[model samples]
Target: MFIRTESFSQYIRQYPVVSTLIALNVVIYLLSLLPFIGDPIRNFGVGSNYMIAQGEYWRLVTPMFLHAGIMHLLFNMFSLFIFGPELEKVAGKARFLTVYFLAGIFGDIATFFVYDSSYLHVGASGAIFGIFGAFGALVYYTKKMLPQLRQIILPIIVLSVVMTFIGPNINAAAHIAGLVVGFLIGLSIFHPKRIISWRKPKLKVVQKR
Candidate 1:
């Protein structure tokens, strides 16, 4: 169930918010490639040790936007492009972005606290993982409406869990933490009842005298 297919876009115009995010990430990646700025930018990567240690805590949130390389950037952005629009369509732009940023922040914070020493870490994986979490919450909330999505839902969760164990350069722990935090946050903020209430606001009509 690749949401990037023509069928998904057939009825829904690409969410401007998500598209803009994708564009911004790409632009940032391009900016990081400039020679003068490239080295510093990659090291700073949304979170640099100096900045982080100096109590520029926002680095936790910012790091997720910076990718270490082209392949890293592409994979993260492509995953976001594929899964994000649909999640935004379901969850709305503001909420989706909130989860994205929060998840990234939490992921970095978790990694920072657990690791004894600092390492250069950057990428949208944390945020992308958040998107996956959001998708899980959305599917669970709308199980009655989206029962067909279970097959899609289960595999993603399973795959993510599996990837965490298949050790590599990937900060799978951060990804896991981000996903869990995002899922919990999404679940709390976007419960089934709240969604129904949000969707069905009482309309006020006024007649001109």
Candidate 2:
């Protein structure tokens, strides 16, 4: 389906939250590359499979901002550029941000279970995928309104699934986890009754002639 929302920059002007997130991810990635920048940034990454054992709960949130490399950052940022704005338009700034962090943390939680905590897991892909998941959720409940998107939904999902297989460090577990949580959040937020009521249909009664 065609993109019905405003352009990304226009959306940014209206809803600056998504722009801030993308900017943060880019800034962190650039910082990670700087030689003088040391373990302070490195410590933000999901370090060595360790859980809350030492009370490092911030790992849940910090990993979403850290990236393995420039390529990783770019891929995730591109995904956000494409999908984040529309979700923000539909869900509003607060809910949109909620979807991002909830999905990201859930994705990281999935990583904790799937990968070694000792393994360094980093990147915004988890959050990006969560946005994709939010899109999928909208496609589910709003199909009547977004019928055009119904046709493109499959191809979009296929592409994402294919991308997950591309690299050894892709962190599909986190991506898939983000998708699931985002989908559920979408369902909760865009439930058919609430959204349908939002568009409140007017039934006109015609007298029998």
Question: TM-score: which candidate is best?
Answer: 1
Model 1 is weakest, by summed lDDT over 10 consecutive residues, at 3-12
lDDT of 2 by residue, 88-179 (tens): 87888888999999999998888878876465688777787888787788888768887777667657776887879895768888889998
* Regions of candidate 1 where Cα sits further than 4 Å from its true position: 6-13, 49-51, 207-209
Per model, state how many residue pairs clash.
Answer: 1, 4
lDDT of each: 0.77, 0.79
TM per model?
Answer: 0.87, 0.84
Q: Given candidate 1, what's the lDDT at residue 176?
A: 88
Candidate 1: tens digits of C-alpha lDDT, residues 1-209:
55566554552466777777788889989988899987776665666555677787777877777887888889888888788877777778888888888888888887777654556578878888888887787777777887777678769878977887785788775798889877887797679678778879688999999
Q: What TM-score quantifies how close candidate 1 is to the native fold?
A: 0.87
TM-score of 2: 0.84
Q: Pairs clashing in candidate 2?
A: 48-117, 48-118, 49-117, 49-118
